[model samples]
Structure formats: structure tokens, C-alpha cells
Target chain A: MIRFFTNVWNNFKEYIVLVILILASLIILSQNKSPQVQKVRAIAFGSFATFTSIISDMFSVTDLKRENQQLRERNAELMIQISKLRKYGIINEELKDLLGFKDTANVPLIPATIISRSLSMTQNMLTLNAGRKHGVLPGMPVVNDRGFIGIVHSVSEDFSIARTLNNVDLKLTVMDERSRINGIMKWTGEELVIINIPNTFDIKIGDRIVTSGISSIVPLPLPVGIVEEFRPSETSGFSYIKVKPFVDLKPIENVFIIAEVQSKQKKDLELNFYRRQSDEIR
Target chain B: MKFDKIFPFLIFFVGLLVQVTIIPLVSINGIVPDLILIMLVYYSITRGQLYGTVLGAYYGLSVDLITGSLLGSAMLSKTLAGFIAGYFSTETKRDINISTFNFSMIVFLCSMIDTLIFSFFSAFDFNTNFVTVLFEHALLPSLYTGVVSILFIFSPFRRKRLL
Candidate 1:
């Protein structure tokens, strides 16, 4: 018995370690939402965010000049837009005062760098340098200058993780800009698909799709993608439309996290409604 | 000899660094080659299954921790792959030729197993279409990882030379 035990231990030590690690990981993952674990994770990721930031800055020295040039052009365009908006603001304010309306302002964009990307094929998440310290919270919408990129999933102190539009975890209420028809946008393993769109909706190839703003956390008309092609399901009376996302996650480095978020109560209500719909379908 | 014990971890760290910075430049359809898996293959082919499996598990755990993905999925898949690759390892370094068709075949098989298991476990259990993910996601990345394994084939470092 002693000799048999020794032989098994000698032969299967690595397997033993593998099992232990896997169990430990499962425990850790399950406890990720606990406050203590979150605090520890936050501190660790904060330090890691600093380390990765330094590395990214060191490696990105070559792109500095080109980035500077692009920034300059963007700044010039912004200046022009600011001047044009100033004229409209005066007219809008005068009308609002006449109507006794509340003042509205655009939410400021929080800029962040993509620090790391998910290594798994089935998941498409990216880590950003901005985190809770930057007021980044889970469910916040992220966008590049061109269009919507993703949603913030979790936040550490100085680092946060996001599930990109390509990930199955992300689902958006989107609209055909031209047709004004609403649909749910999600990623299949292959492509971004808007399923169950009524066949009556006049969605065509090359039509723009944007956020419907029906979701509490995100705002209206955020550019999502362009329609590629759609096909009607005769039996279901719906269309499966494929979309080409505007922001290609592969090459994106810098992105802005929109600070706009609905109140907790509102968001919770919307979430419950979604859960109910899903349960009913199931 | 002690360096052999530490070298795998060092390679794993370097693999992470290269994967994020350099591999993104050449990603095909948003799928980057798994560099650490390639290292696991190299080490497993040079050493035996036992050593390779342990190293692969550690490598996978490190990746999950750093990348902030679902933990243990990579470790489980990679450990099994390492065990499989260990059988293909020769008893002696002198008997093994790293830069050969046989080496590529071994790497290909190991990557295939790693990706298949990793994708299966990581994917959403109910919602995902298994066959679509198996083909669209796992197959291409495995092929890409196999292609990238060619770089290690002709590298200066070999187990015999290092020793």
C-alpha cells in the first residue's frame, strides 16, 4: 500500500497540482463579487495598471509624432464646432428662458488607454487604464471617436475591464437610423447580428444602426455599426441582419468612456424588465 | 539546472508581454497566436509530459490572472494539452530535432486541444452555438498558433545547449 501510494504520488503530482489550481481558481472566481475580494483585486489591478501604463508609454514612443498630428487636426475641428455651437447656444438659451426649461449639458468623456486584451477566443474583453479612481463604473458605455466600442464590465482602482461589442456578453438596443425600427444587437460567434427584427422594417444594406437609448445606462443615437445584409425568416416573421461595427477593436488604443449613467433605481427597473423578457422567451 | 526550473516562468512573462504588444500588430481576424502555449509545447517536447503539464498549468493561471478572464479555464485546457504533448517528447535532446515537420505536427495537435477545450469551457454554455464557435473561433486561432510556433523551431535555445 505504501509503495503503491508512493508510485501514484510520483506519477501524478502535476495532475494533482492542476486539480488544486483549478479548484482554487473556481473558488476565487466565484468570490470575485465579494467586497473583500474586490478590494484586494482593485489594489492589485491598480498597481498592475501603473506597470502596464509605463510599458505602453515606452513602447508607443514611435507613434507620438503621428498622434500629435492627429490631435492637432481634431483640436482644429473641435474649435470650429465650438464656435458654431456657441451661436446656437445663445438662440437655444433665449428660447429655453421663454419656455422655462431646464438647462442641459453634454456629459464629459473620460479618456482611457487599452492596456490589455482578452487571451481567450470565446471572450473579447479589454482592460483599460482608467478604473474606479477615474469614476469608471460597470455598465458605462465606452466609445471611440468613430462609434460605440463596448461596455465597462468591472472596475478596479486604476484599471477596468470591458466586454467589447464582439463579445456575447454585450447586448445593445439598436435602431435603424433610416427606418427608425428597433432591434436587439448581439454578437454571434461569427458576426454582429440583429435578430428578430420585424421583416416589415425597411432595413437595407449600408443603413446606419445606432443605440435606441431605451436602455437606462446608455444614451441615444450612439453610432454602433452599418448594416451589411439581412435575410427574412419566413417562419418567424423576423429578419436576421448582419452589421459591420464602426470601431474595429483590434487596432483601437485610445477610447473615451461616457460618464452618462442612469440612476440606480431606473437601471434596476430596466434590468428587471429585460430579465422578465428573457425568462418568458425561455 | 536551477535556471531550467525558473526559465519556464520567465518565458511565460515574456510571452504575455509579446502577446499584448507585438502580436496585436499581426492578429488575424482579432485572434492572436497563443505564445505561451507555444512555449509550453517547446518545453514539453524538450522535457517530458510531467514537467510540461505543470508548466502549462502555471502559465495558464498566470494568463487568467493578468488578463482578467474566467480563471482556470485556460489552466485546465492547457494542462491537458501539456500532458498530451509530453508523450511526443523524446527521452534525449540529441534525438529530437526542433525544426522539423514532426515538431510542427506536435505543436499543431497541442494547440488544437488547448483551443478546443478552452473555447468550449469559456463559451456561454446554453446560448453559444457549439459547432459555430468550434469552427469560427477555435480552428483559426489554433492554426495561427501553429504557424507562429515556427519561430521557436529555429531558436538558439535548446534544452541540451542550455544545460
Candidate 2:
């Protein structure tokens, strides 16, 4: 029996190890959402991001001249837009006062620079220099001058990771600015697509898409993308809408984190309503 | 020999550093070469299969944790890739494999499998177009990694000399 066992071990040891590691990986995959795993992941990435930020800082210096020029141009553009918006703001405040509407413009923005990026077809992620120490938190939206970039996924002491719009795992509720129609938008590995819109919907090519106010992840509306293509399914009544994002994530360096999550009051109200409905059913 | 055993891990860290920091700058249409896979293939050819398999798991898990990819996706793909690459590690042809164009070919093959398995775990669905996924996620990245591996053949410090 010992000799037989030794022969099997010598001949198939590689296969045995491979199977063991494969099983270990699957177990880890299943534990991805556990708090302990999340803690370990946060620590691991936090330590690595410190080293990566140094390398990123060295490379960013070479692009400073070009970035400076672009920022100057963008500043001028925003100056003109802000002047125009100020006129509307005064009238809007007076109208809001008359209607007794609550102000929602007090959201804070935290500035940060992209320290590194993990570029993949389906899992594109960005590491930023802001984290818990900087008041950055998961689920906050990261934006640039162009528009929305991504949502913060994880945070540590000095760094945070963001899931970009190109990542397959992120799904968002977006609306058409012109038509006021809402749809679920996601990265399809090949493109950004708004799925399950009926063919009769009023969406058209070149319509601007923005985050919907109804979305739990991002309650405030923000520019997302523009509809690039609208194809109706041949067999089904649904249409497929492709979006071209305003922000070209590859070249972006600095971004602002909109330091907000869904309001707790709203969440609690919704939860209470659901509880009442379930109680009635019971 | 001790230095040689520890050397691949050091290369993995440097490769990972370049992957996350510098590789994005050179990305073509959001597709970049897998620098870690190329290094894994190189070391698997030099080392034995068991060593390659274990290293692949370590490298893949680290990438998943740090890069925010699905935790086990890369781990599974890279382990299989390392095992396949180790098949070419026979003593008789090991030198010939590293010194010649064959190294690039092996890298290409292993990279394709690596990317395919990784994509399967992360992105595959019934509605997806298999051909497009194969072309974009598997082929392009593997070709890029393979082309980059050609540099190893011509490095100033050649195989066995560097270690």
C-alpha cells in the first residue's frame, strides 16, 4: 500500500497540486463579498498603491505641460458657463423659495489624482491618491472636466479603487436628456449599451444620456454618455442603444470625487414602504 | 540556485509595476499586453511545472487583490497557463526554447489560454458573441504579449546569465 501510494504521488503530484490550487481559488472567489476578504483586499491594495503612486508621480511630470494647457482652456470655458448659469440660479432660487423646495446643491467635491490604472477588457479599474484619510469613500462618483468617470469601489488609508464605466460589473440607471426616458446602462464587454428599451421608445441617435435621479448609487443627475447607435432587435421588440462616453478615461489624470452616497432618509422610507407592503401580503 | 529560485518573484513585482503604471499609456483600444503572463511563461520554461503552477497562482491572486479584478478569475486562468507552459520545460530543449523564436510562440499560446480562461470567468455569457470576445479579449492581447516576449530573446543579459 505504501509503495502504491508513493508511485501515485510521484507521477501525479503536479496534477494534485493544480487541482488543490484551483479549488482554493474557487473558494476565495466565493468569499469575495465577506468582510474579512474585503479587509484583506483593502490592506493589500493600500500597501501596493503606495509604491505605485511614486512611479506614477514620476511619469506624470512629463505630461504636466500639456495638461496645464488643457486645464487653462477648460477654465475659460467654465468661466463663461458659470456666468450664464448664475443668471438662471437667481431666478431658480426665487422659484424654489416660492415652491418651498429643498436645496440639493451642497454636495462636496474632493480632488484627487489617478495614481494607477488596471486596464482590462471587462474589469478596468483606477487607483486614486485619495482615500479614507482624505474623506473618500466607496460608492462616491468620480468625475473629470469631461464628465462622470467611475464610482469608487474600495478605500484604504491613502488610496481608493474605482470601477470605470468600461467595467462589466457596473450597471447604472441612465436617462435620455431629450426624451426623459430611463434605461439600465452597462458595459457589454464590447461597448456601453442600454438594454431592454422597447422599440417604440423615443430614443434617437446623438441623444445625451445622464445618470437618473432615481438611481440609488448616484441620486443626482450627471452626464454619462451620448447615444452612438440604436439598433432594434430583429426578433424582439427591444432596442439596443450604444453610448459614447464623454470622458476618455485613458488620458485623464485628475478627477473630483462627489463625496455623497444615497441619503439614508430616502433609503429608510423605501425600506419601510416595502416592509408595510410585505406585511399586508402576509 | 537560491537566487535563481527567488528571482522570478522579483521579476513578477517589476512586471506588475510596469503593467499597472506604464502599460496603460501604451494600450491600443483598451487592450494591453499581459506582462505578468509573459514573465510567467519565461520562468515556467526555465523552472519545472510544479514551480510554475504555484507561482502562477500567487501572481494571479496578487493581481486580483491589487487590481480589483474578480478574486479567483486570474488565479484559475494563470494556474492553467503555467501548467501548459511547463510542458515545454524538458531539459533537452529548454535552452533552445528560450534562445530562439520559439519562446515568442510559446508565450503567444500560453497568453491566449490565459486570457480566454480569465475572460470566461469574468465576462462570458450566453448572449455574448464568442467570435468577437475571442478576437478582442484573447487574440489581440496574446499577440501583443508574444511580440513583447521577443525582447527577452535579445536582452543584453540573456537567459541563465542574468540569474
Point to the candidate with the largest DockQ.
2
Among the numbered candidates, top lDDT falls to 2
User: Compared with the true structure, what per-residue lDDT tens digits does model 1 show for residues A1-282?
Assistant: 999989988988767765775676567657656777555545655665566676777766657745854674364335324433543454566786798854334556677888777776556888898888889988888877667888987788788988888776577888877777888888875689997778887999998787774655465457788999889889889887999998878877777787767557767787899999999999
For model 1, how does the per-residue alpha-carbon lDDT over B14-67 read when each residue is reduced to its tens digit? 678777666777887778788888888877767777788788788776666667
The candidate maximizing TM-score is: 2
Q: Candidate 1 — which pairs collide? A: none
Interface RMSD score of candidate 1: 2.7
lDDT of 2 by residue, B1-163 (tens): 7987888877777889899999888888888988899888878888989999999999999999999999988999899999999999999998888889999999999999999999997678767899988999999999998998899799875655535
Candidate 1 chain A: worst 10 consecutive residues by lDDT? Answer: A75-84
Tens-place lDDT digits, model 2, residues A147-213: 7788999999999999999998999998887787999999889889999899999999999788887
Q: Report the Cα interface RMSD of each model, rounded to 1 decimal.
A: 2.7, 0.8
